[model samples]
Target: MSPVDSNALNELYKAHLAEQQRRTEHALQRGGFDALLIASGIEKFAFLDDRPYVFQPNPHFKLWVPLIRHPDSWLVIRPGHKPRLVYVQPEDYWHVPPEAPSGFWVDHFELIVVRKPEEALPYLQVPGTLAIVGEADAALGDIVPNNPPEVLNPLHYARAAKTGYELLRLREASALGATAHLASQRAFGEGRSESAIHNAYLDACGFAERDLPYGNIVALNEHAAVLHYQYQDQQAPAQSLSLLVDAGAHSCGYASDITRTTGNGDASFQALIDAMEAAQLRLVDRVRAGVDYRDIHLASHRETAGVLRQLGIVKMDEEAMLAQGVTSTFLPHGIGHLLGLQVHDIGGFMAGEDGGTIAKPDGHPYLRLTRVLQPGMVVTIEPGLYFIPMLLDKLRATPAAANVDWALVKHLSAFGGVRIEDDVACRETGAPENLTRDAFAALI
Candidate 1:
């Protein structure tokens, strides 16, 4: 991986902080509050065990600063005032404490450090109505998070558009994730087990499993048919026909979600993979300002139906196949979703800052995003074609069964599925930027 220039990053962070401050001030005024408090959430212990589960910082808090691993910290923001960060540096031998906050961002914030969580409460006392943003466990004394929708609605809606600093971080994350993907592809070609390929991905990215943005989907052969495939087998399949790796990496707090499918010397399956790539690229090209995301998803279904006809898997025309719900059987999930801060980011279904919703198209309940594309908004375009036994069996019982070629379906089921995903950024004009492709191209 290429080294990130710290000097450039620091400058970008300064601008990012300014934008965050401006947004917060507007949100506070809209919510009729004088102050807003965001907490770095506390860690929770496993049931009947002393070991704590992984600590996830609140997205609301991390948006202002890059303090991802630190918990029990707080950010106090008041309109027309410099934000205050109550850094908690507990003195304990049981675990290593967080180092004192020091970075380009630290200078912009009014820094306050204490030995315990409760010690910082006095400093948080500000005049007028103060709105807290965090889980109930993060509350201290009488102070608790109300999570006012009036304030959060606008903030969540605005987060869909990435800042310049956010775009840079997301690009770096894509490059890192692409590097890991290349390593995993090499491992798969060498006929390694699913667990081994997963390990290679982790090693190449230099991130522990717990540090990843989401659980890695390292599936082999028939396992690829399952979306969000979880477990990793220690032993390689007797005959490896295909491999589907849906995984990602993070830069700072931003995330990149990517997926790739590879076939092992299977000519027929390779053709299907090629076809899916073409269809996915077509969908990615449709991402730009003013385009509705739901149309892209519906287009993906049409493309998948076309692939089926081209492959002789279905004899019916595209229109008939779509009307009969044949395409839904092969492609069960949505084409893609908004990618950033969280893998499936918030506000995809929100109508506007005033708190309304844009309902999903009828019969497409799993679709994650329904808003129109806008400049600086990053999303994933993933179109898939799978042959799951359950779905196929259900289709067999329907009147549309006569249209499908069951023999061809059974043959292709050994290879499982094909999914090509890329993270794209909508632009002001012309074509949208393909971040995943650019990251992979850099590897050359």
Candidate 2:
């Protein structure tokens, strides 16, 4: 990874902070609140166990400052006033304490350091109606977070549009994820076990398993059929047919999600992978301001149907296949989703900033995003075609089964499936920026 230009980042951070303040002030006013309080969230212990699960800071808090590890912290924001951060740097012999707040963002906030979580209460006694934002667990005594929908709706809706600072971090995250992807691809080529390939990915990115934006899908062969493939086998398959790696990296608080598939000397399956790559790129090109995301998802179905037909798997025209629901059997998941602080970011289906929903297209229940594309929004264009036995078996009982070449399906099922994903950013004019592609291209 390249060293970040701190001077440039500092300037971006300033602008980003300004925008956040503007958004929060608007939300507070709209919700009839004098101030907004955001908690960094507290750690929780596992059921019947002393060990705590990895703490994930509130996205609301992260939007203001890039403090992901700190817990029991609070942010106070009121219109026309500078934001206040009640930072906690607990004194403990069992764990290393959090460092004092520093960096370009610190100066913008009124810093209030406290040794214990309760100590920060004195600073939070601001006048007027305060809307607290955070999980109920993070509430300090009677000051539980209300999490009013009126305030959150607009804020969540507005988060879809990325600030310049957020885009920079997202790009860096893509580069870091791409580096790990290259290493994992090599590990797969060398016939490494699933666990080993996952390790190579982490080693290349210098990220612990917990640091990842989400769990890595290090699937090999038939395992790829499972969309969110979770487990990693320690033993290498006797003969690896294919490997599908869906992994990502985080920069600051933003995340980059990318996926790639490789075939092991299978000429026919390799062709399918190539075809899917082409189809995915076409879908990526379709992303821009004003286009409905559901249309892109529907387009993906058409593309996947075309691949099945061209490859002799489905013996029917694309339209007939789609009408018979043949395409759904192969591509079960959505074409893509919004991407940012969360992997499947919030507000993908939101009607507007005031809060309503844009329903997913009929029969495409798995689609995650249904909003119209807009400039500054980032989304994933992931189109996949899989041959899962469960779905295929159901298809066999239907009349549409006659249109499918079962023989070809049997042969390709060994390779599991093919999915190519890239994170794309919508723009106001011209073409949308392919963040994943550009990051990988830079390596060459």
Candidate 3:
């Protein structure tokens, strides 16, 4: 692994600060606020216990400083002067408290340490003029006011187009994830249990489960039919047929959501995987500036129908299958979603910085991202097909039942599903860059 370029990171933060300040100033003008007061957020206890769950700092606070080392900190940003940071260093015996943060980024902020949350309140002037931008901090609630959507929408919208710095981290995160995916694929091909394959992924990525952006989905055979499959069987099935691994890795608070499917002993299943991969690549090529994402999503449904018809899995014409919703039973969910700091990052449907949102099409309600393609935006293109019993059963009762080849369905159902996903970044020109594929190539 190569070292992170600290100067580049500093430059990224500088660009991010400029963008944020622009959004904040616009929002403040629109919402009648003087300054923005942001809390890094505090830890929450797990159910019925004092133990804290994994802590995630507020995206607003982390935006300015990737303060992965500190929690319960606060940030105050105004039009002028250096940004102020209220660093927290707890004096506790049970666990090791964070040391005062020291990094290339530290010099950018005016830092102050407080043992408790209340001690930091005295630093703010005219708190009533400030609009809160993070987790609810009751200590400052009496003074600071809640941030209305007018103030938040623009900031959320600004994140959709990442800085050059964020793009670098995202590429690194995708590379890390692809490394783990290769290990998991090998483990699956070797007949290892789902639990073991998942462990191999973690070992390859060098991170704990809590550190993951989202829970890893390691599904084998029929288990792949479950969209959010969670359980990891302790023992491998006697007949290992298919593997569907949806996992990712985090790099400096950025994430890469990638999925890959592999098959065993069945040429037809391999063909299906190839078809999906080809279809996904074609769709990814369309992810450039000025393209409407919903149109791409609809295009995916059309291609899926074509693939199913080409394979004799569905008998109806492509238009008929799409019109009757027959295509959804086999390949449901959106073609892809925005990928960045969060797995399903925010601002996917927002129409503008003032906070207008667009609704998903009636037939395709599961789509997470509806924004048009733009330069610097990153997204995932995941297209899948499954032989799920429940969906198949429903299809069997519908008018579209005649479209499906029940015999072929029965024959291939045991092999589970096929999904091919890749993370791509929309460019200022030409086709989007496939970050996941580029990462996988590095392994060779």
Per-residue CA lDDT of model 2 for 333-406, tens digit only, reads 99988999999999999998789999999898989999999999999999998989999999999998987889
Residue pairs with backbone overlap in model 3: none
Model 3: residues >4 Å from true position, as ranges? Answer: 1-4, 126-128, 137-145
Give the whole-model CA lDDT for all candidates, comma-separated: 0.92, 0.92, 0.86
The TM-score between candidate 2 and the true structure equals 0.98
- Model 1: clashing residue pairs? none
Model 2 whole-model lDDT (C-alpha atoms): 0.92
Q: Per-residue CA lDDT of candidate 3, range 320-419, in tens?
A: 9989999999988899898888889899999998878788887998999999889999999998999989889999999889768899888789888988
Work out the TM-score per prediction: 0.98, 0.98, 0.96
Clashes of 3: 0
Ranking by TM-score: 2, 1, 3
Judging by TM-score, tell me the better candidate of 1 and 2. Answer: 2
| CA shift of 126, model 1, Å | 1.2
TM-score: the better of candidates 2 and 3: 2
